[model samples]
Target: MHTDPDFSSRGRRLLCGTLAASVLPASLAPAAASAAAGNWPQKPLRLIVGFPPGSSPDMLARAVAEPLGQALGQPVIVDNKVGAAGSIGVASVARATDGYTIGLTGNGPLTTAKALTPSTPYDVARDLRPISLVATSPFVLAGSMAMPAADLRGFLEFAKAQGDKLSYGSIGPGSGSHLAMELLKTHTGIRAVHVPFPGFPQVATALMGKQIDLSFMIPSIAVPQAKNGRLRLYGVSTAAAFPGSGDVPPIQSALDRQRFDVASWNAVFGPASLPAPVAERLSQEIARILQTSEVKQRLLEQGWLAAGSAPGVLAHKIAEDTAMWGGVIRLTGARAE
Candidate 1:
């Protein structure tokens, strides 16, 4: 369980990996839109979610749906299109010809998942248009109490000894969760088996129930349990620590590696054909909605920091993550299950 993540791309530099970056002047941002409909959103909006209900992406989308709908004076309906490590649902959004269809998704399908699986349905650069980054959360490398190690250094030694006798769980084949653990294996030369779950809940259950030995869990599922002492955290995927919490160190410090970082972020996007003006309007409204006290508090409770960024920031992030995760994928030989 954990709180806070380090986001990649421009939001990391501009936002300090925190939503507070919204207050910083986005000199690049266009004027905030006064209204959402002119020739855009002629009807109810469909917000696509690639993961199942209760996943971080779904929660972030649902968090903004009602308020975003109110701001646009049109209903925003959440549509979950699960499977294929989230590529299926994101592909649905990218395939839509209607301007009203957009999606909120995270790191894997947007970048690494596609790299891990060339057949991944949509090309983020070619098929999707950026809107705003909804939120970012760091990954926690959690271990079970039954495991022999309490700290990460100790855990790695034990994992090295155990080899394939030990196993790790991930939300899916090509998710950031999977990549983080795969990178860890590359660093420490551990030979743990890989197990894939449909979502964080199942992963968390597997770890706590002793069905699996370790897993890199997202904040929404990891933080609350970590706070309650239901699970033991060995390390985090990034150098930066979670706000208000200490003790979880970056995975690099223990491995004597040059660097290591991993995080999951949710962002909104439309089909590549979406008009620039409509994208700007949606970015402004979404950022506005994220800044609200009510929405902010709700997101914070789920261990997510809301970031309603300009579309350009999201575009910058996608490009950066694609290049970075691609390099990591190649180095680690990470692949879809």
Candidate 2:
């Protein structure tokens, strides 16, 4: 439930995980041309996930693989290649020349990694092409229950009052949680000490234990704590009230004059040379998949809102978010360790 679902790749054993592909439809022809007479996906397609099994990206990859394969008239196999904050797996996808291999990952490797680690092997804009966005969820600004702040405004006043003593936690430097908090600080003209933790679990523990003052956390992880009265949710980082989030207003509602929006998004991407026909058809198929009631319900139950967009739309998102986070990284003076 961390901002980057692929964060599981950090400090973990490397296991090449795989999801067994579903059997192709009996009516479907074995020829790749069955789908649309394309010279692609001549055999089983490889869908590479940068994170290990059960991570957010892996889950997304698994959920979409069967349908995407069926639509493309091939078996979509998920191959987990985990390491280096998901950069290793992404780099592999970038180097893959065949259209048969694609990547399903989140912000960590795609958007945030470049600003944090400029020396990363592959450049996102130059190497990979955007296919479509799968789903998204806003991060909640949460406070410990022990704190006196009752809402976003009160928390802001409290943070302003504390000044140098106010402290917050994030998964690590340059993560979405870290950068989002920094962006909030810049917008609101407030400052707080930052305490970097290894992951969301630790950050939640520290907050519940009253070791930290506040943090930006994903709704799935923060909701349970709030439900049990261990955490007090203040604001969600979005333009409007997020669905399934308990009556929490957008962060802009607190600031009045300012607006802020950030979310963890899972998307599909392939090497830059992926043919337009393939990318366009894949986007259309994914959009259809997302519209299905079953898939929508499953993603919502997991604290995600299913969203699909054209390839150019996703490309715009990637560019915009990359620039936005790059500014935050510079403002916070955060760099990869």
Candidate 3:
């Protein structure tokens, strides 16, 4: 009976050892294969845009998607998840479980949205990882050519004179247009009612129709209208005149010793905890893509300057812009429509 019990104990121990050996190797097999292959982005990649179709960010994302798809040897899809000042798309990207998901972000959701809406679901710093900054452009302070404000100084004086009666249009609350206008209002102490539009085209149309008195717009979209006498270029929202539009002077130059600056930018971001190797690879490919002559010409033609910044550089920029816009929002008491 003692021999039988001892033999049974040995058999149980052997079975347990065999199970551990089988399970351990199986559990680590995927990790080992991943390490050996370095096969990041093994699946199709999704680039999420916070705006609807035909928007600036959406356009850029589409432009880059095909080339990036070729670079990664995987199909890249642009997913437009528009809403809540782009927070909806951004939050979707943040919550995505796949490593192949990235967000095409702009000033709205990335920097100014949180400041305008404190209840933002994802932390820009904690939930998203910066991939690269694609481009930058200065905002153009434009108005109806019919208005008396020919320049920035005259515009401010006109705004002050109009006082509570003055109204301006923005794409939406927490948009770059809104923040730029709010910053101008805060700096100049001019009070104007904010009229929110669904998108830039609507805002531009409203300006053309004289539905809105004044608004800040991007040079690519607004300058042509100004040239066609549909709208007048009052000033640019940069310290110096933008490179492409020599006729439009800087807002600071027109305002006596008062400084105002506002610009728009686009960047790529991936979900938090994206593998470092994957991020680095994507950054390198983006930098290369931006360096292409065709890409440069296209961006310049659109009134944008190619940024081509690395991942770390873009991370720093996001941090800096977030803090800067937070103060602007607080000071202006800006809010959503």
Candidate 4:
């Protein structure tokens, strides 16, 4: 669990740079910006995504592209580049030099992946520049219908009693879902064997079949099943209510917990060499697009809260989560497989 000594300093620079841009006199904002983007994006822009099509991040990128293209007066095409828990596409975004390539990625490649597998092709704190935090969604901690627990608190107690006899599934080895459960174990002193699955679909199927006792799954896969009553939704990993999770309180709220505020998120990022003005323009446009009722509702339907924010906000978020997940990884001794 080694960390770069300069991570904090570089993170501060990333945050400070955006704050400086936000407050700079309107006339002077673009003064030092690279001319690569001067009247730029003359052609279609490429939005690289590491996950496959139809996945939440890919869908979110596609959702943003249409309106973003209209606002930028250019088409924004989505490019699917899958692998390594989303590190491949994120690395593609970092390596881009045309100033026309950006990425929409989630917690896996951006933060958690690096901690669990430190040899990623790109360094998030150095090679990438955050543009905007698109949105956030808490992982829904779910269980099988036959399980004894009815809620998060009860589930924890049951897990403690079962010890390692019970098992939990995640999308992969270094995913946010995996680390989220690991974080819970740290706070609650519960023990369960970790089972890695390919994605939420598989995790959902496993839950319904009673193949696993628990899993932290995405809402898109977990929420709609309540009608069937095949699986149980215990609580959300975050403190707020998920849009469609219906009456599922936050895990923290359930037991008066201290630090169970884990959640997965998506954000926009560009190569580090991208001009400040260009990045700022993209961030502003995304902020506008996310605010429109049309876009917000669309994202809500996809199991996300539209959170358009300044570049610094995303920068700060990445830094904070990287450290937090790093600690969880160390505590759980979760090395890359």
Q: Provide the global lDDT of candidate 3 against the true structure.
A: 0.75
Rank all candidate structures by their TM-score, best first, as comma-separated numbers.
Answer: 4, 2, 3, 1
Best by TM-score: 4
Mind giving the per-residue lDDT tens digits that candidate 1 earns over 142-197? 88768978888888888899969998998776677777787777667888898989
Q: After superposing candidate 1 on the true structure, give the runs of residues whose Cα lies further than 4 Å from its correct spot.
A: 1-41, 153-165, 209-211, 227-229, 244-247, 252-257, 331-333
Write the residue-wise lDDT of candidate 2 on 183-247 in tens digits.
99888866888899988999999999999988999888998899998999999998878886889
Model 1: which residue pairs collide? Answer: 1-222, 2-222, 2-223, 5-138
lDDT score for residue 233 of model 4: 91
Question: What are the lDDT figures for the candidates, one per model?
Answer: 0.75, 0.79, 0.75, 0.81
Residue-level lDDT tens digits of model 3 in 1-337: 0012333443333223312322223444453245225766577888999988988888788778888999989999999998886789999987764567888978678776766777989866656667788988998987865578777677878878887887788887677888788878767877988899877789899888888888888888898888888998888888877887767888878667776766789988876645555666888998888888988788888888777777777766665566666766676667775
RMSD of 3: 14.5
Q: Of the pair 3 and 4, which is ahead by TM-score?
A: 4
**Superior candidate under lDDT, 1 versus 4:** 4
Give the TM-scores of the predictions, in the order they appear: 0.78, 0.88, 0.82, 0.90
The alpha-carbon lDDT assigned to residue 111 of candidate 1 equals 69
lDDT digits (tens) for residues 257-335 of candidate 4: 4857878889999877666678889999999999999988998888999988878788899888877777777777787
Name model 4 segments beyond 4 Å from true.
1-7, 16-38
Of 1 and 2, the candidate ranking higher by lDDT: 2
TM-score quality measure for candidate 4: 0.90
